[model samples]
Target: MSLQQQFEQAVTDSKALPERPDNMTLLKIYALYKQGASGDVTGERPGMMDFVARAKFDAWAELKGTAQETAMQSYIDLINSLKG
Candidate 1:
């Protein structure tokens, strides 16, 4: 399957989880997955977890004030666009 197909599958699968993920976690996971899938290894950057990644996750969580389905959908849309 194409990357776009994979992303679409991921989006559908993620949404089917019994417990929805926090929006920020979903966003960060989306970012990491995109970077990894593209061979950027940005997700593997040294200190990414301690510095930027964690911060972004925290910020998203705070900004949403709760898990936001829209944020997850946005992440899915981003991946779809990237794959296009």
Candidate 2:
């Protein structure tokens, strides 16, 4: 399957894992998915007062300059690990 398709499928499968993921794992999934789909962060960072938004933005920002294919592969690998 195409990498993007595989990424999408991994996202779906991740939600079906036997055990729930911790908050950090969820955040990593969110960040990697965003990076893989959109490539790097965009717009302004969320204000520090907005913890959730700030966290998401920060997580995505950390992946700045990462290649889309790399992000997708990383996301897929993480999902597979979580599944097992």
Candidate 3:
């Protein structure tokens, strides 16, 4: 299958993981998904008070400069791992 097709399937599969991933894994998933679908992080980081948003933004920012295809593949791999 095409990389994009795999990525799209992974996106759907992510929602049905047998168990929820840990916080850090979830962060990685979010970051990879964002980088894959939207390319690099954008807009202002959330303020300190918005802890969850800030953490998510930070996680995504950490992937700065990652290519979209690479991120998509990473996301797909992660989702598959979670599925198992």
Best by lDDT: 3
TM-score of 3: 0.98
Reference-based TM-score of each model: 0.34, 0.92, 0.98
lDDT of prediction 1:
0.50
Q: Number of clashes in every candidate structure? A: 0, 0, 0
Models sorted by TM-score, best on top: 3, 2, 1
TM-score of 1: 0.34
* Per-residue lDDT over 1-84 for candidate 2, one digit per residue giving the tens place of the 0 to 100 score: 999899999989987998989888888998999999999899998887999999899889988999989999999999999988
Lowest lDDT 10-residue stretch of candidate 3 = 75-84
On the 0 to 100 scale, the lDDT of residue 83 in model 1 is 42
Model 1, range 1-84, lDDT digits (tens) per residue?
654555567666655655555665556765544443342222333355476666654444343322234444455665444443
Clashing pairs in 1: none
Tens digits of per-residue lDDT for model 3 on 2-81? Answer: 99999999999999999999999999999999999999999999998999999999999999999999999999999998
Which ranges of candidate 2 are over 4 A from the true structure?
none
RMSD of each predicted structure: 12.3, 1.0, 0.5
The C-alpha lDDT values of all candidates are 0.50, 0.92, 0.98
Pairs of colliding residues, candidate 2: none
